[model samples]
Target: MGLFVHGDVGTAASYEPPYTLSSGESVRGGERRLWDNGAACGRRYRLRCLSGSNRPCKDGTVDVTVVDYCRKSPCPSTILLSTSAFSAISKSPSAKINAEYIQ
Candidate 1:
């Protein structure tokens, strides 16, 4: 099981693209590269989650790379992901999640 933190992009700025590193730092071009390589920002992830919601409950797997930055103040960390990223690992959306990071 992964320590998944799930939240709406609108609610959590971390869910935005151009993810801000927890270190309050980032690498130049790192975010763009991830997006250029077919990564989904919050928009894409949300669509996947909504779509997944319509399907039979199962452990859906999606390969998601974080991109951009979510500036919401209440988010625990700047690590943002597409809801599709969460859907890949979670079946329930109503519960709070602690997501595991895949290396």
Candidate 2:
């Protein structure tokens, strides 16, 4: 299992402003609710919508619970993936992501 991050922005409850996270930021918050570097297959991440709104889960920040690894580009090191992480993030359904990892 590898740690995946967000790469792009989209239209979702988490994608709103104020809570929206820019690139190059860790996806961790309080204990128990944290983003790790390892996850299993067919897992689900309990994330918080960065936008923190009641809107639809189009795109936004999330707290992943580590499900499966993504076999895609710029994923292994991505800190903020595209809307695709919705599955892993448990907000949206699925997404086609392109993200950059934080150093």
TM-score of each: 0.36, 0.24
Candidate 2 residue runs with Cα over 4 Å from true position: 1-45, 52-65, 76-103
Per model, state how many residue pairs clash: 18, 19
Candidate whose TM-score is highest: 1
Error of 1 at 46 (Å): 18
lDDT of each: 0.34, 0.32
lDDT of 1: 0.34
Lowest lDDT 10-mer window, candidate 1?
7-16
The whole-model C-alpha lDDT of candidate 2 against the native structure comes to 0.32
Q: Could you give candidate 1's per-residue lDDT for residues 1-103 as a string of tens digits?
A: 2233553322111132343443322211123322344343322232122222334334433444343543334444323444444445446543234332332
RMSD of candidate 1 to the truth, in angstroms, is 11.7
Q: How close is candidate 2 to the true structure, as a TM-score?
A: 0.24
